[model samples]
Target: MQETILNIYLVIDKGSVTSFRAKAYEMEGEDSAKIGFLKERATEDFASAFVFDSPKNKKGEYMPYKKFSKLEKQGLQYQLFEEIFEKFRVPQNPLICVTPVVDGEVFGKK
Candidate 1:
């Protein structure tokens, strides 16, 4: 069995509740060199928020909420993510999902 390697990048914006632009490339081989390359590219390309850490699964996406809630409950981190909920409600920065070049098809058709 063989494993398919994927390259993903994210752009995090700073100011309020950090926003991001995520991109993923599904490629052939897992080149160790490319991992470092991706890290460098992502850092340079995304200007605002710096890379805190690598990406994780979706289910864990909302886990930050739980963690922040605990912190707020325990009086830890001064500001919680929920504190900026109202700001995220604006239209100019509506959430977006972009799936580029899926399975060698740019628009989903081969």
Candidate 2:
């Protein structure tokens, strides 16, 4: 069976410098349930945005945020989760980003 890669990204709005495309955070090979949880968190935090995608498709198609957001209002929620930190750090700003070429070096290493 093919592994599911749940890709999480940060979408800068039209006014921001990085508004052209979504900035990738990390790819997650999690089950649908965990993916759902990640989506839920993103929806609540980023509002109606499809920053999370399945790169397996490779189409780079934008997922309908409204559809997910509408269904979630019916009480979809997660209680607890495990924390795994691999690429989270304060480089130039407090915001957590993983853009290597645009955001500069990872962990500020030369």
Candidate 3:
């Protein structure tokens, strides 16, 4: 048997910058129905952008902007995500990403 780790990446726009992380975590979970709901709730605390984990088949592959018709290569969404990360203390520029890297685990049925 193997256990899978699931994580969601979200951008927090804290007005003060110091309290955003706390606010972001407070709203993330499996129970979340609407991504916008979390963002709206946290608007007072900070603005947030949540990136749900891509399907396994899509792993390691490039993800493009949802609004853009072009494929990942031409998509600027990834770069935009990085731009948001840089706003925090993260050192990486648009080229580097701060999203959580997750590994999956499956168990055989007995």
Judging by TM-score against the true structure, name the best candidate.
1
Which parts of model 3 are misplaced by more than 4 Å? 1-26, 34-76, 89-110
What would the TM-score be for candidate 2 when compared with the true structure? 0.23
For residues 16-110, write the lDDT of model 2, one tens digit per residue.
Answer: 22311122243344455545544444423332323332211255443233433454475331100001122232122122222211232122122
Backbone clashes, candidate 2 = 0
RMSD of each: 16.1, 15.1, 16.1
List candidate 1 segments past 4 Å from native: 1-16, 47-110
The 10-residue segment of model 3 with minimum total lDDT is 101-110
lDDT of 3 by residue, 61-92 (tens): 33332322243347543543343353333334
lDDT: the better of candidates 1 and 2: 1
Q: Best to worst by lDDT, what's the order?
A: 1, 3, 2
Candidate 2 lowest-lDDT run of ten: 77-86
Note the Cα lDDT for every prediction shown. Answer: 0.31, 0.28, 0.29
Cα lDDT over the full model 1: 0.31
lDDT of the structure predicted as candidate 3: 0.29
Predicted structure 3, TM vs. truth: 0.23
